[model samples]
Target: MAGFRYEEVAGSIAGQVEAGVYGPGDRLPGVRKLARQFGVSVSTVVAAQHLLEDRGVIEARPRSGYYVRLRPQRPPQAPERTRPEGQPTQVTGQALVLRVVQAANEPDTVQLGAAVPHAEFLPTHGLQRAFSGVPRRYPGRATDYLFPPGPVELRQQIARRMADAGCRLSPEEIVVTNGAQEALVLSLRAVAEPGDVVAIESPTFYGLLQAIEGQGMRALEIPTDPDEGISPEALALALEQWPVAAAMLMPNFGNPLGHRASEGRKREVVALLEERGVPLIEDDVYGDLAFEAPRPWAAKAYEDRGGVLYCGSFSKTLSPGLRVGWAAPGRFRDRLEYLKYAASAATPAFPGFAAADFLARGGYDRYLRRVRGEYARAVARVRRAVARYFPEGTRQTDPEGGFVLWVELPAEVDSLALYQAALAEGISIAPGPMFSPTQRFRNFLRLNCAQPWNGNFERALRRIGELARERSG
Candidate 1:
């Protein structure tokens, strides 16, 4: 307890800095002074100072005392609430989405497009070692076909991890898929039939749109708030007007928008869907990456009626190359299992075994702690860069979790053209229109903030800002 006392002291100091009581660049109290002030020993105060320094909250000069570290100015105002017309529209933009995906994968381009974590932050060596041992661990696993529900050990580990997100899941309810994409596709197929209307958040992930289109379903864009996610009122109105089959949403740290629906909003949405007997598919890929302490609760945590289908994957937190994703399909378990069998036959066994071993050995949570801190710092740096580089009147999202920022540029700038220009300059960005089924955000774009800050990344931001100015003119 004494050893951990410094964390409390550091937190007190961090609170002071956040409250502006200790302004940036202001020297903190001397160790002796702080010891006296907090009724702790001088050694404890020194530990507290070291902790603060490690968190980037304070710095130590060679001869001087610790001082609050200067950070980038507060980010520009978040974009306004989205106003998507409550109309069921056929999903398009597959061609543009394909082009952007191709460009994002180019080796020479600066990757600011795809919502993927950089490999440097991942546990590459540990995962490789785990993979190497998989064959020996399960002699025939490499050559065998894992059934629809996947490896028992992986599902068991996933069920244990789900407890952190406030969901009490069982290994039996979980079904493994190629990735979250496959999980999402299976959930969609299990719930809604072809030609049925499914409601989704406006400015949602492009991959969701692709999934909906692939299922031959129409998308009903709901008005979504930048901070609170989809509007419950808009969703209720849409439900009243249309014969909605099901709803898909990212209730915890949604992609593109990076908004988390409030628990109350989640309850309201869930209640409405339950009342209407509609299935709710929740994309929780970013749930474990919360920037702050105490990870936020998932939408499925409030589901008492088993109407929520919870989908998650290690792609965002762990290695995407593993392609290990799973879903707790609640009431739709049988249908989803059937869909998984029909779609891909079965998920590969090697990655599931590797991921399961990684989780069982407790490496996953430790890696999450490291990457969560990195992502928080990286998001702050990216926001500051956007504030400095982008044209005037540009707005961006301040995400609570996850590694993506949604930027709304000046109306005069066409984000598609900006995407082209950025690509030509060996940079990749996800244009705004790609996120919507109707291609609505012509002047918007999304940036990936997972990569560590570097000179090349800075140069890319500067170039994008210059291009934004040119396009505005």
Candidate 2:
């Protein structure tokens, strides 16, 4: 019993709290008293108290005593902020790099985890050609940080381009980021706090989930339709039930889900949030890479206030290596821009300059046409492969645009095990669980339709399916 003194003290105190004997706000015995009761040293009692404090069981008062702080309740979560309104008051933390490493180290694995495009889709040679000319056009631009809002020429180009989507932006509103990830991270950091709740799509992007986890914030998962994106009614309920500080969503071809929110719903969403004074962070990275007929509208088009923070990246349309993404933070422009500067100083200027050149060549739309055509064909091939290889009960989302396929396997199949099993056969796939804050997609997998259904990819899918069968069986 002597050796178990600290354990006894901690357990008895914890039991008191659990039993409501020491109700919230009630004071616990001091070190001397607890030591006398438990027959432990004063230091031992103090250590036990500190342990309880760290566990959020009690709080220390300044010469007053340790009292229960009521384990601070979090109000229910609200909907994620949609476009054209609301600030993204969410705190995001460090990104997970383990899954990335596994996929990178084993090149033979069937690739499907990351949102990165196939190496062939990248315009590496074209980038090189443009880079070579950067010196002649702006000799020292690459050597310097573009600063807060970004390079003037690049920002102007972005403003001019967004005109197509009816997003009238002043060059002053745009802040360049290393990638869309940085834009989301910085926007969240600017608007949210450590314990604030942020609503997100149920089967959202894993990276966003990791960001939420890293920031020590709470994620409220909202029901999302495969076609129409997040449910408006469900979001409104969340808003009413929870004290959400902000929300983040991918309005256009959301990562992993590959669904676009309708323009009408977008307006309704913004208006609802504006009434509640909430902010929205819109991820539109795949807005331009739609494989469907015409491009969908931008969420920012409906903005009448400063709540919407719009994010886009050239990685999908141009080159990932470029890592060029920009944000138009309507009301929080200064704060978002300052965060961008503080976080990374600025995005590499040469890429922005080169991207401007690429866009200015008047071939940007033409290139998009070609890219969409290829993506459409690729999606078709992958769909057929899924039909042929995956089990009969498998349900897959047919995204209207973009190149992600969220496949729901039979309830018996566990995606985490499938990921491990597939990796053994030189294949990689995103396990379903990572997409939600609580890892709810245990029976799901996100397939990248960006890659062609070639021998390697098909073989990978076949192996993944086989693994799924093994787990299911």
The best candidate in terms of lDDT? 1
lDDT of 1 by residue, 372-466 (tens): 76676677777778888899999999888899999999999999999999999999999998999989999999999888678999899889999
Model 2, 1-473: lDDT tens per residue?
54467667777888776554664456887789888887779988887887788877788989899976443111122122323122233423223336643584465656787766786766666777777888788887778878878888888989988887669888888988898888888888878888888988767876676667777788888878776788778789889888987878888888777777889988888887878888898888888877654688787888788898888888887887788998888888889888887888867878888888877776577777667766655655566577668775887766666777888888899887787777777777787766766556678888877775567787877777777777776
Off by more than 4 A, model 2: 1-97, 100-105
Backbone N/Cα/C clashes per model: 0, 13
Question: Cα-based RMSD of the predictions, in order?
Answer: 6.6, 25.4
Candidate 1 deviates by what RMSD?
Answer: 6.6
Query: Model 1: residues >4 Å from true position, as ranges?
Result: 1-76
Error of 2 at 263 (Å): 1.3
Can you give the lDDT of residue 297 in candidate 1? Answer: 85
TM-score attained by model 2: 0.78
